[model samples]
Target: MDSTALDLGEDNSLLLVDDDEAFLRRLAKAMEKRGFAVETAGSVAAGQAIATGRPPAYAVVDLRLEDGNGLDVVETLRARRPESRIVVLTGYGAIATAVAAVKIGATDYLAKPADATDVTNALLARTDTLPPPPENPMSADRVRWEHIQRVYELCDRNVSETARRLSMHRRTLQRILAKRSPR
Candidate 1:
């Protein structure tokens, strides 16, 4: 898929799907600066609509969205364009989710807070080559903390619910939440 560098012309189009408004806007602007004609959608429905009508050559989709799972949009894009390069981003990264995304035709599965450059590289890199490691990869502890925070937020910030969901002691979850994140 990465036989060529970043494509130009109409096929240099990119679709970005994410529920985070600020992140979407920032990524759109950055990709546009990188010479892609970018379109964005904030929900799975909207993303699916755009993909069905005109699947772009490149795409960056979040694993979870307010309306639905972003993989639905990924499937839509693949149905329309098997050659499209798709990258899935998620804050709650898990091996099962990554495997599912890849099976459904994702080019790469990246954890949230992925640098725009990393996304671009994933979008353009050849499938046959090993990608360079991210310059600022998250530490294992940081990834764990981020996953916990995401689960905590999804549980509506209820300590007990978060703890139950995470299978951790309520007091331990509280202590972890109370402290600053690890570097």
Candidate 2:
């Protein structure tokens, strides 16, 4: 969504879900400062419990959680609180994952390192609403994986070259591609 001006309410409550304790705490504090009542969960179970009981007006979910994948969290949120706007965040930021999040009823998907303003804006933009999740289509993960492999090949399997072309770091590119290859 465009980062246009928004009028956020003081009564709006936000649920921040992420495995990273520091990140979650920092985000909660920031959102609280922006007049949002914020609560945090470090695992999918805790998040689901809170969601089922008293859903917040907004949710910020991480792609990976210690208990399970964030997609499960999305499912739970949609089931219990369809009115709650949900935004998925990930450091990976793969296209396939982003598309999947949209398909699964997430209002928006954001990459990690996004600041409090970014998160606040996302929640505010979703005040309108969203549709329900559809039946599972073919996940784009395979296609994305293939594309990444092709890029790695084009870079002659060189992490530095691949990172340069991908506009990412050598280690980050290597880590992303390593899942497909053996250790």
Candidate 3:
């Protein structure tokens, strides 16, 4: 209708996945009206199937699905179709989850209920900076901390075996423990 709208037409192909049937249909139609060649899937399995068959240029994945977490779908799509940009959406979005998504492989993360324009911008903006996704946002440090905390609870704060199981020197584990304890 306007020049800006006309300019937005070129990048359109998208694969949209959500568990809510009505929401999925409405989004599909809205994206279509905006010139996207949109495909809709109501479950993770269906979305994975569609992606494997004919991968789109981008994807919009909800955080939770009827069958499973949408992160699994995102992982599958990222593995099978690396070129496809991914934008993760969640109705229960939090800072940690949003950061994790972005750090993992998402081009962008949105808090639903996101409008059609919100979705489009995220999918389209994938081109601006193509950073390689981190191998794991939950880094070894974080994992070690969690493991130590778990072992500490199980072993009643025993420092020896936790360090052994964690495959680190007792001194190193103690240093980590010191950080965790109150100063």
Candidate 4:
């Protein structure tokens, strides 16, 4: 444990949903320091359960989990607490998914490597004000690479299955998957 758990008064509660345990602990500690009483869940099921038991005023949800999509949790949370502020974080970001997240009640979408500061700002942002557009949006190649990587993971890293689903030659898919992601 990073630190002794503190009593989180209901008014200051927050829920963090992510599969990365280490990142969860670190973000929980950081959020605690920033005055949120943090509750964490490592899967969509756990997150939905937490929200059902007691919907927090705020949430930070990852886009993917070991068990299911984070969007499900977001939908549950929104249904449970319509006023809650929710931000979606993803290591694999796509414009389509980002738009879907907003439509599903997420207040903001952040591509990962987002830190506690970024999450905090997003969660606390005024709903009436629009956030500034990204100064450097992802290039088409980067987006395609990210999409392929996501689908590859979804296919359990099976090259043949992924290639089939992507309608690409197996060797071509393997070659692209093998290369480092573009900046």
Candidate 5:
């Protein structure tokens, strides 16, 4: 089935909040083409501002932002529009965070590299069943690399801090970060 073909009607307004400027722009354009009135924000504060002014019917929020957690924006969106369908998108997806997001009112939690079709399905699904899992899931090494990268980012790209948090030697962390992500 073409998930993107699901028409949310003329009143289908959406807010997309992410720190990646290029990704945000592309996703906004894609969503607009798919029949949503799209508004974009690059931070939690900015998202909150737009949402407060006019709450969207749907929202796609990133888990990490320059200013704050996307959950903060999700909370505000839910407060403003109790019926809003919110989806939390994250590069650093974790079971704990996903559970927290759902508990706080998000309709779905998706990992990064999610396309417009995935977002639409997440926003409009009537059932709890998630989209089919990826055919080829990441290998253990690849997942470890991704997690290390996420931690590095969260630590403001500080090698020492990331190493300390991960309980690894600084040089080892540096070497891992320098290597290309595992396939």
Candidate 6:
């Protein structure tokens, strides 16, 4: 380890981007201990700068940043390193955005409050296999409701657009969105 850079080398290089200073610093240390040579950025531009210079083998990027969307960072990294394993983290989870991330080369998408363990599992999981089923699956009704909510968010919460895409009447979609979802 270069006491200063803590760099292990290229194969294990990691980039972590998040506007949350505390979380970024914490994860950096945790990842370093796990054998990655970690580098971190707090905003999209900074993250892009580092990614452009040397796209790491792995990355963890927040979906929303103060300056711009973190998806932009993911795109930059993917463009620079096609084989890089990138994980997208978001406080607001939406199916549309998740699909967008995967389409653009993100290896995985995780909702906010993910721990080091969760991130590690996602980062290293085989891309070819399906993830194991949820320990406690959501009820069919709840699943339906969640899918509706995801589409609604993807449509920027525009009731008309969501209704149009869902092929349902505006009033019906509105009623579904308005109802409290089942826990």
TM-scores for candidates 1 onward, in order: 0.91, 0.66, 0.62, 0.73, 0.83, 0.69
Superposed model 2: Cα runs more than 4 Å off: 1-11, 126-183
**Residue 138 alpha-carbon offset, candidate 4, angstroms:** 4.8
lDDT string for model 6 (1-183, tens) is 121333334599899999999999988988877778889999999999999998999999999999999999999998999989999998778899999999999999998667776777788788888767555666889767877888899899999999999999999998988889986
TM-score of 1: 0.91
| Over 4 Å off, model 5 | 1-5, 153-160, 169-179
Candidates' C-alpha lDDT: 0.90, 0.79, 0.77, 0.90, 0.90, 0.87
Question: Which stretches of candidate 6 lie above 4 Å from their native place?
Answer: 1-10, 133-183
lDDT of 1 by residue, 71-168 (tens): 99999999999999999999877899999999999999998788778888888788999998766777999878988999898999999999999999
Ranking by TM-score: 1, 5, 4, 6, 2, 3
Query: Candidate 5's C-alpha lDDT?
Result: 0.90
lDDT of 5 by residue, 1-183 (tens): 352445686678899999999999999988887888899999999999988999999999999999999999999999999999999999978899999999999999999988887888788888556577766878999989888988899899999999999999999998998889889
Candidate 3 least-lDDT 10 residues: 1-10
Q: After superposition, how far is residue 17 of candidate 1 from its true place, in Å?
A: 1.1
Tell me the spans in candidate 4 whose CA falls farther than 4 Å from its real position.
1-10, 91-100, 134-140
- What lDDT score goes with residue 144 in model 3? 51
Q: Which residue pairs overlap in candidate 4's backbone? A: none
Ranking under lDDT, best-scoring first?
A: 1, 5, 4, 6, 2, 3
Candidate with more favorable, higher TM-score: 1 or 5 = 1
- Cα deviation in Å at residue 36, candidate 1? 0.2
Model 3: runs farther than 4 Å from truth?
1-11, 126-183
Give the better candidate number (1 or 6) by lDDT: 1
What's the CA error at residue 164 for candidate 6, in Å? 21
